[model samples]
Target: MKAALVGADGALLYEVRRATGRERGPDAVVEGILGFAAELRAYGAEHFGESALAAGVAVPGIVDAENGIAVYAANLGWRDVPMRALLAERLGGVPVALGHDVRTGGLAEGRLGAGRGADRFMFIPLGTGIAGAIGIGGTIEAGAHGYAGEIGHVVVRPDGPECGCRQRGCLETLASAAAVSRAWAAASGDPEADAADCAKAVESGDPEAVRVWLDAVDALAAGLVTALTLLDPRTLIIGGGLAEAGETLFTPLRAAVEERVTFQKLPEIVPAALGDTAGCLGAGLLAWDLVAPADGPAAVTGSGAP
Candidate 1:
């Protein structure tokens, strides 16, 4: 888990990182987050002469953001956890906002990063798992059930591979960082090889590495093109580990997207400028929004559902 003590101006005055300690069990992890949040609130009160006006938390998984319910996080083994109420009780009545991790990051990108000027944008992170956040104005459209931007589950290749969502041929199965790592490691006969290693091999003109890399790129392009057709976003912000390959990933991915475009207006695909700080900044925005609504698209809140 990561957090920050952000001022009203959205600047982080102090920051912290902690392990979720999933090995200690899901309940323990949840409790740990609650305690850490409460501590941060107290710290701000002690040092700044005031407590935090509001707090925002972003988490991974299928979240029911509006009600502050962490619906289910497969990796953390969480289901129906009442994060907002728990944290609020601990923080002594401070208002709290809950959000999806990816959407929160997108909020930051749209408001302050690569998508700053685009009213409609999409932030897609090709990380361990693929996920997306659609930014309209400065807020992410969380959908009626807080399940919008689930493009990773879009079936781009019906016969491709099975996803953890128990669906066949989902986009993430073929294009995510984990998928690339798995494929490259298998193809290169190195059990420990990761996506970064694949990129290095591709740079060195390894045929197998090039083939594997191209396959993932092509799959990603398909998913992106489909998204463009549906949303017609003015900007598409790509982030996460695979993007670290820089031109190696962008040049070909751009070309592939060009090849597939027929009638859609091509969005300016750019790498996320905020790096790892996007989510933290977004959480701060949401917290500020809670204290002052009617303010410019304050960070996407648990109330941002749909």
Candidate 2:
């Protein structure tokens, strides 16, 4: 879990990381987050001479942001957890904000990172699974049902591997980091081969790795084209594990997207600038939003003294 004490101008006054201890069960994971947050609040009071005005947490899975509930997260084994209320109560009734992880990260990216000036942007992270965050104006849209930018589930291949969303040919089934890892492991005859290794092999001009990489790129481009056709974002930010390949992913991705575009204005594609801390910084923004002027900028920089 990532936690922080953020200043009104979005400075990360303090930060810490710890294991979620999921093996101890979902309940324990919640307890861990609560305990970690309490510690952060206490530390902020001691070091900065005041308790945090508000707190924000970015979590994975389906979140009912309006109600502050973590509705479901398959990986974390969470369901219907009233995260905001719990955190608020734990931290002596301070206001608490709960956000979807990808959306929260996209908020940081849009307001302070790669998509800073884009009025409309999309943030897609190619991790174990693929998900997206839609940024419009200054806020991330939660959609009518809080499932707005789920581009990964878009079907790009009619006959492909199944996805955890119970759909075959889903974009993530063919294009996510997990999918590339699986393909590379099979092609290289190395069960432990991962997407990072696949990227190295691609750099080395390995035919199998090239094939696997291109296939994933193709699927991703197809899904992205579909999304762009509808959203018409000004910038498309690619992030997560697969994006660590740098140009290996972007060069071909750009080409594939260009080949497919017709009437849609192609958005400038860029790597996520904030890296892994986007989520934490975004959470800080959320907290700041509760206290700062609605028209004010996040004005945050992680370079502050710890």
Taken over the whole model, the C-alpha lDDT of each candidate is: 0.88, 0.90
Error of 2 at 76 (Å): 1.5
Question: Clashing pairs in model 2?
Answer: none
Candidate 1: list runs displaced more than 4 Å: 295-306
Please provide, for model 1 over 234-292, each residue's C-alpha lDDT reduced to its tens digit, 9 standing for 90 to 100: 99999999998999999999999999999999999999988888888888777777876
Which candidate ranks first by lDDT, i.e. highest? Answer: 2
TM-score quality measure for candidate 2: 0.96
> Cα deviation of 232 in candidate 1 (Å)?
0.4
Q: Residues 1-306, candidate 2, lDDT per residue (tens digit)?
A: 888776655556677898999999999999999999999888988998777888889999999998999999998999999999999999999888889999999999998899998999999999988899999998998899999999999989878887778888999889999999999999999999999999999999999899999999999999999999999999999999999999999999999999999999999999999989999989988877776636324443333322
Tell me the deviation in Å of residue 180 in model 1. 0.4
